[model samples]
Target: MNTVKINWPNKKSSNCSPGVDWLKAAYDADIEIPTGCLGGSCGACEIEVNGEVVRACIATVPDKKELNVEFFSDPYW
Candidate 1:
C-alpha cells in the first residue's frame, strides 16, 4: 500500500496510508486537531490540506505523495 507524507501544522511529519482518517493521521503524528463534531457539522476540525481547506472530521488523506496541512484559525473560536 502506498503511503502519503503529511506535514502537520506543528512542523511534525508522519507517514500514513492513503484514505486514512485525518484525525487518525494527525494523532499518529503526535498532533492534536481540535474537533467538535465527528459528523462534520461543526467547523472545529477545519484544516488546510495542500492549500485546500477541508473538514478533518469528514475528510480523509488523499492519494498523494506529499501533503502539507495547516490548522484553520477561526477568530471567534
Candidate 2:
C-alpha cells in the first residue's frame, strides 16, 4: 500500500496509508484536532484537506500523493 504525505495545519507532517482515520493520522503526528463529537454531527472537527472542507471525525486520509490540511477556524467559537 502506498502512503500519502499529509501537511497539517500545525506545520507537522505525516506519511500515512490510505483509508486511515483522520483522528488517528493526527494523533500519529502529535497534532490535536479539536472535536465536539466523535461522529460527524458537529463541525468542531472540521478541517480543510487540499482546499476541501471535511469533518475529521468522519473522514479518512484520502489516497493522494500529498495533501495540505488546514483547520477550520470559527471566529465566534
Candidate 3:
C-alpha cells in the first residue's frame, strides 16, 4: 500500500494510508483543517500540496503525493 506522509507547518506528522483518504483521515485525526462543507464543492479547504495550491476538500490523496498541510492554518495567499 502506498502511503504519503504529511508534515504540518507546526511540525506534526500525519500519514495518509493507502486506503484511508487524506482529508478524512486528517479530520479524523483531529489535525483540524478548515472546511465549510465536506462535499468538496465549496473549495474552502484549500492547501498547498508540494508547493502547488489545491483544494484539499476535493483533492484526492495521490499515492506518494507529499503534502505540506500548513496553508490551512495560514490562508492569505
Candidate 4:
C-alpha cells in the first residue's frame, strides 16, 4: 500500500489508509476544526483543499502522494 502524507493547514503530518480516516488526519494536524455531528450529514467538518471546501468526515484519504489540505476553523460564511 502507498503511504499518503497529508499536509494540513497548521503544518502537521499524519498517515492513514487511503479512503479511511481523513478527519483524524486533520485533528492530528493540530487544527482546531469543529464538527457538530460525527456523522457525514451535518456539514460541520468542511475544509478547503487549495480553495475548495471538503468535508473532512467524508473526504477520502489520499492513496498515492501526500495531499496538501488547508482547513478552515469555523470556515462557514
lDDT scores of the candidates, listed in order: 0.90, 0.92, 0.68, 0.69
List, residue by residue over 1-77, the lDDT tens digit for candidate 4: 77777677666767666766666766655666677787778877787766667887777675667677775556355
Candidate 3, residue 12: the lDDT equals 79
Per-residue lDDT tens digits for candidate 2, residues 1-77, read 99999998778788999999999999999999999979899899999998888999999999999999999876887
Off by over 4 Å in 1: none
Q: Cα deviation of 34 in candidate 4 (Å)?
A: 0.9
The C-alpha RMSD in Å for every predicted model, in order, reads 1.1, 1.1, 3.0, 2.7
Question: In candidate 4, residue 24 scores what lDDT?
Answer: 71
Model 1: weakest 10-residue lDDT segment is 68-77
TM-score to native of every candidate shown: 0.92, 0.92, 0.69, 0.68
Q: Model 4 shows how many backbone clashes?
A: 0
Which consecutive 10 residues in model 4 have the weakest lDDT in total? 68-77
Per-prediction tally of clashes: 0, 0, 0, 0
lDDT of 3 by residue, 1-75 (tens): 777787776687777775455578677556766788867777677777677776766677666756566574444
Q: Please give the ranking of all candidate structures by lDDT, highest first, separated by commas.
A: 2, 1, 4, 3
What tens digits encode model 1's per-residue C-alpha lDDT throughout 1-77? 99899988778889999999999988888899998978999898999998898999899999999999998887897
Which of 1 and 4 is the better model by lDDT?
Answer: 1
